[model samples]
Target: MRRGRDEQGQVSLLIIGFAGVIAMVIAVVVDASAAYLQRSGLDTLADGAALHGADLGATGEDVYTGGLPEERLALTEPAVRAAVGDYLRRVGAHRSYPGLTFTVAVDGAESVTVRISAPLDLPLRFPGSPADTTVSATGSAVSTVD
Candidate 1:
């Protein structure tokens, strides 16, 4: 049997290619799962923060206690931001997610929205995977009087 130069290292090249592909797949899966899980956790946290911003924000306690001075309920921008910040600090969100950033928005007088973002570190450093990425989640809440 006669062997050509092309055939000599063909098997080795195929093995290396397959190995690279497998490593890339693993990296993608791990990083993707991490991002997804972080997003889910952030969603829950954002929901809680939104609720806190709406209920414990400026004039929030007064309204809940039936002590509002005005006929309508209103959520002030500064108040909502402060409330969300306090809530996150109390819950240790900053400690849990390093480099966490958040924003609070008031949708008129009835709704408060909380959006949180954080940098995600990849567990696996593959050829195409970024060393760091960002994940974010948003939550909103409305105040109602019965």
Candidate 2:
């Protein structure tokens, strides 16, 4: 009739359960931190791409309006696209993750925008195809009339 011996097993079970919970919490913390870093990086990439594209567009407009009538729209669009693409690739979106996509568009003569998106796989939450998150930036610069 010794109650102390029986209580020892219960203590062990509780300890094991607490340890498992602690491990799970640590894993969650690490995963969340990594996701945050990835998100931040993507945001920077989007901003850079948009700004570069916009600069190109704005410059083209300035050149054309500054008595350069021979400059065609096709040349401007391609230059913007190439600049955006180069920025995106250098920023690791095209090389790092396969679930990322970029969309760049020329919005008129003085504006350009770039959209960057990625699908993140987050476990311990609703399970399914992860939701796609997108970050976009638009920049506009106008030519000053002399």
Question: How many residue pairs clash in each candidate at the backbone level?
Answer: 0, 0
Tens-digit per-residue lDDT, 1-146, candidate 2: 65544455788889999998787787678667767777787777777777776555445554656654343332256777787787677776666756677776765554566667766555454333236543333333232233
Candidate closest to the true structure, highest lDDT: 1
- lDDT per residue as tens, model 1, 20-81: 88988888898889889999999999999999988777465545676664444677778889
Using Cα atoms with residue i matched to residue i, what is each candidate's TM-score against the true structure? 0.85, 0.61
Candidate 1 to truth, TM: 0.85
What Cα-based lDDT does every candidate model obtain? 0.86, 0.62
Error of 1 at 117 (Å): 0.6
Error of 2 at 107 (Å): 5.4
Stretches of candidate 1 above 4 Å error? 1-6, 58-72
